[model samples]
Target chain A: MSSKKLFLIGLLVSFLVAGFFSFYSSSQPDGLQKATAEQGLDLTVVDSANADSSLANYGVAGIENERLSGFLGGAIGVAVVGIAGTGIYFWVRTPKSGETK
Target chain B: MHMPDGLINAQVSIGAAVIAAGAITVGLKKSKGTLDSQTAPLAGLVAVFIFAFQMMNFPVAAGTSGHLMGGALASILVGPYVAILVMTVVVSLQALVFADGGLSALGLNLLNMGIVSIVVSTILFAGLMKLLPKTRISIIGVSATVAFISVLASAGAFVFEYSLGGNATYNIASVLISVMSVHVLIGIGEAIITGLTIGAILATRADLVYGARKFLPAHNLLIKESVVA
Candidate 1:
C-alpha cells in the first residue's frame, strides 16, 4: 500500500476510535485508580500538572457537549501525537549516510 | 498502568525517569538502524492506533476498567527499539496533554508502561517466536500469550516501584496481591486486542509488519505454491 493510503487509514481509524467510539468507553476509574482507592492509597495521588488543559481527561475543557468534547479531544490527541511523534522520529532518526532531515 | 503523581516519593519518580531516559537514549540509537524513511510513518501510526485504543477502556472488574497497553502489540508491529520509542511518545502525550497521568510521575509511568512492558514483551516474544512455527496463526498465538504476560510484568513493575517509593503505608503483601489480580484480567484483554489487531494487519499488509518481515518473502512464495497446488 502507498504510504499516503496507510497514513490516511491510520488517521481514519484514529478519528473513528477516539472521536466517535470514545463515547462508549468505560467511565469508571481504571484498574490502578480503583485499586488505589480501595487499597487506601488514594490519598497519595497528586493532581496532574495538565489537569487544567483544555483536552484533559480526553475531553475538551470548555465544550458543553460531552461527546463533542471527547470527539475534539480525541482528534487533537491524534494530531498532536502524530505530528510530534513522527517529527521527533525524523529529527533524531539516524540520517542515511548521505541524507539530511 | 499510568501511575499518577503523589503515589510515589519524588526521589523515586525522578530515579525511574532517569532510568527511563537512559533506556530511551539507547532506543534512539538502536532504532535508528530499523527506522529509515520507509518505517518512520508506520511507527507513528502505531502510536496513534495504540493511543486511540487506550481511549476506549473496557470494564475488567467491579469499578475497575482496563485499556490496551499496546507494549507487546507495538513490539510486534515495530521492532522493540521503535516500540519503546512509540510507547514513550504515547505516555508522554497522555501526561502532558490529556492529564491522564501525572506529570511528576511521568518517569515511573514511562518506566512501567514504556520500558518495562516493552523490554519484557520484546524478550518474551523474541524467545517464543523462535520456538513457534513461522505460520501467521502461530505467530499470533505466541504474540497474544506473550502480550498477556507482558501486561502482568508491567503490573509487577508497578508493585515494585510502589514498594520502593510509594507514599501509601499499605502492606507490601496486600499491595502485590491487589495489583497482580486485577492486572491478570486486564492482561487477558490486552492479549485479545494484541492478537486481533496483529492478525488483522498481517492479513492485509504482511509486508509492512516488522516482526513478520523476516517471514514474509517465504510466506508469499508459499502462498503462490499453495495456490498452484
Candidate 2:
C-alpha cells in the first residue's frame, strides 16, 4: 500500500479509538491509582495546576452531556497531537539531498 | 503511569525535570541525524496513536485498569531517539492540555514513561535482534518481551522515586510489591498490543518498521527455504 493510504488509515484508526471507542473504556482507576489507593496513599490529593482547564480529566468543563464532552475533548486531543507531532517531526527531519537547511 | 501531584516531593520532581530536559536535548540531536521524510511521518503517527490508545483504559483486574504506554512499539517503528520525541509530545500534551498528569510531576512522568521505557526497550531490542534469528516472528517476539519488561521497568522507576520522596510513609517493600504486581498484568496487555502491531506492520510494510527492516531480507530468505521444503 501507498504511504499516504497507510497514513490516512492510521489517522482514521486513531480518531475512532479516541473519539468513539473511548466511551466504552473501563471507568475503574488505572494501575497506579489502584496501587496507591490500596496503600492508602491518595495521589490526587493535590489538584493539578491545570485542573480547571476546560479539557481537564479528558472532558470539556462546561459540557453537561458526558458522551458529548468526552467525544469533543478526545477529538480535540487527536487534532492537537497530530498537528504538534507532525510539525515537530517536519522541523527536525533531515533535509533531502538537494535541499539545504 | 501518569503520576499526580503530591505523590513525589518538589525536590525530586525538579531534579527529574532537569534530567528529563537533558535527555530530550540529546534525543533531538540524535533524531536529527536519524529521521528523514520517510520516517518522520511514521514517528508523528506513532505519537498520535499512542495518545489515542492511552485514553482507552482496559480493565486489567476487578478494580484496576491499564492502557498502552507505547514506548516499545514506537521505538520499534521509529528509532529510539524519535520514539523519545514522540512520547515526550504525547505525555506533555496529556499533562498540559488534558490535565491527566500533574504539572509538577510532568518530569517524573516523562522520565519513567518516556526515558526509562524507551532506553530499556532499545537496549533489550538491540541485544535480542543480535542474538535471535532475523525473522518477522523473532522481531515480534523481541517486541513483546521488551514491551513487557519496559512496563515493569517504568513501574520500578516510580517505586524508586516514591521511596526517595513519597509523601506517605508506606513500607517500601509493600510499595514495590503493589506497584510491580499491578504492572505485571499491565505489562502483559502492553506486550500483546506491541507484538500484534509490529507483526502487522512487518507483514505489510516491513520497510517502514525500524526494528524489522534489517531482518526482512533474512525473513524472505527463510520463506524461500521453506518453499523448497
TM-score of 1: 0.92
lDDT tens digits by residue: candidate 1, B1-229: 7887799998999999899999999988888745556556778888889999999999999889999999889888888888888998999999998998899999898888888888898788778878877888977898899889988998999888888888978898988888898999999999999999888778777766778776655656336635665
Q: Which residue pairs in candidate 1 collide?
A: none
Q: Which candidate has the highest lDDT of all?
A: 2
Q: List chain B TM-scores, each candidate.
A: 0.92, 0.93
User: Could you estimate the TM-score for every candidate?
Assistant: 0.92, 0.94
Error of 1 at B124 (Å): 0.6
CA lDDT scores, all candidates in order? 0.84, 0.88
DockQ of each: 0.59, 0.68
lDDT of 2 by residue, B1-229 (tens): 8999988899999999998999989888888746656556888899999999999999999899999999889889998888889989999999999999999999999999999999999999999999998778899999999999999999999999988888886888998999999999999999999998888788777778988766775546335535665
Model 1 in CAPRI terms: which quality? medium
TM-score of chain A of 2: 0.87
In Å, residue A44's CA in model 2 sits off its true spot by: 7.5
